[model samples]
Target: MVQVSESLFYKDVLLVFFEKEGYVYSNSSPTLLENIAKNLNNLSAPASAPKNFIVVHKKIIATSAFAVGGLVLTPIIVVGLIQAIGFGVGGIAAGSFAAWLMSLNGGATAAGSLVAILQSIGAAGLTAGATIGTGAAGATFMGTAGAKLFEEKSDSIMADLTERMDSNPKGQAQLDEFVKVYEEGNEDKNSEKGSTRVVFEIRDKLLTNNEAFKNFLETFVLAYNASKKLVNKKQQFKFFVDKTDKMDIAGKKLENLNVHLVKNYGAECVDKQAQSCTIMLNCSNL
Candidate 1:
């Protein structure tokens, strides 16, 4: 009877975390997603809050990972809202854009596998003493109250696309061509990380083509525009400087995966790599 009562009781908790612009997500659990969505409006940056606010119950789990040698040590804690506007959704879209990446030898997404994809882009994190689950499927989940998302939430979209690429002969042919080229170029220091390097190399090569670059730019701009709908108008955002450096503005934008700079990207950041530049990332709102 006491255990039943405890199960029904919800413990309230709050977490104030630093909001990194172009990257706002902290976890990939349904509970976190629903929590983030439901409290999107209330996640305003407090006067002293570095980035954003997190109001979660005991149901949510939190974790931090430490990479040592080739192994990752993760400790999880039941804890944590995340959904933020600006580059939050935009950032996620970029990864979704990279989902195909023609698989790394026998992997998918930029992170190798579906699970790795989540970790690579910071979409998912470790669970304290939880199994290292590494598979994905589409489905929806409910929040503690009445929160729900429109789709499988995430990770599913990328996985689904990867699976489909396998059965399509056209995709297979393209994949073969890319694999051949990547392998040739990969003769030097190629490994899993090399796969990531290749992905970027492919983007750079594709962008060099005038027509391809135009289409690419349009696609992302449209995607970003669509993502803006996810952010509530009343919610406010600001950027704080974390690390500073002099580089081309384009480099800064690329470094942070910023989607808000398309309007002036060509006018200001692109092709200015040789010139002096400033490096900045979306920091916790002041």
Candidate 2:
């Protein structure tokens, strides 16, 4: 149930963000990866039945794992933040936990574009899930990811960018050129796969492209903080997130998300004394 708030439904919007900001390598694989793709896709798809009734999709998952409510690590998008954060806490990809519960009773749905958007973001994020309980199932994996993210953010490329945007503030020209490259790349119709390839170029220009990998640190941090919030007040979990319509998701919401990031553990992290976390997917897939 590890879900990222910004990534849940906005995967499509993130396509714009990732394309405009990140790079997309045409690293397409063989049909052999279809099972892995399926497993990833299942992580985002609408719940089709109860956790135990899921039939244990063995294409990618070899054992009879009790896949409960899952979320998209971001294959992303949807608009809600807090609620989706709840999913991150749960150790699933980002989408919906309450929705998963609804599926158990109403049967799973076939939301095509929704799944596709999620798949896109999912590619950037690590997919994981945990059982339904106030135990380590979700916390184990999420906490680890979060701690790592926090521990390394200082060196991550995005951290540098955020630092520039936050501290230097005068380097708007470089950041702007970075945007221009993305724009030109998107329009060139001949760029690699005609997709966004500006991430590397921008990183190269900034300092080192090789080090400028996608900053999924925030993703793990979201899972960590949300997980802590969820586990500490198990009964009040529902109140933590405010459910919103899938269509309501937008790129603009990321602003608040950025703020949320700083408040949680980014450089702007307010609680200086808080310890790093280690979280994980609670489920056991054999």
Which of the numbered candidates is closest to the native, going by highest TM-score? 1
User: In model 1, which regions exceed 4 Å deviation?
Assistant: 1-147, 150-156, 168-199, 202-209, 221-272, 275-286
Q: Provide the clash count, candidate 2.
A: 41
Q: Give the TM-score of candidate 1.
A: 0.23
Q: For residues 40-125, what per-residue lDDT tens digits would candidate 2 score against the true structure?
A: 23333443543433243323223312236543321112222213322333333534443443232122323432222223323334
Predicted structure 1: lDDT: 0.25
lDDT, candidates in the order shown: 0.25, 0.28
* Candidate 1 per-residue lDDT over residues 71-127, each given as its tens digit: 222222211122121112233333221222222122332334432333333344334
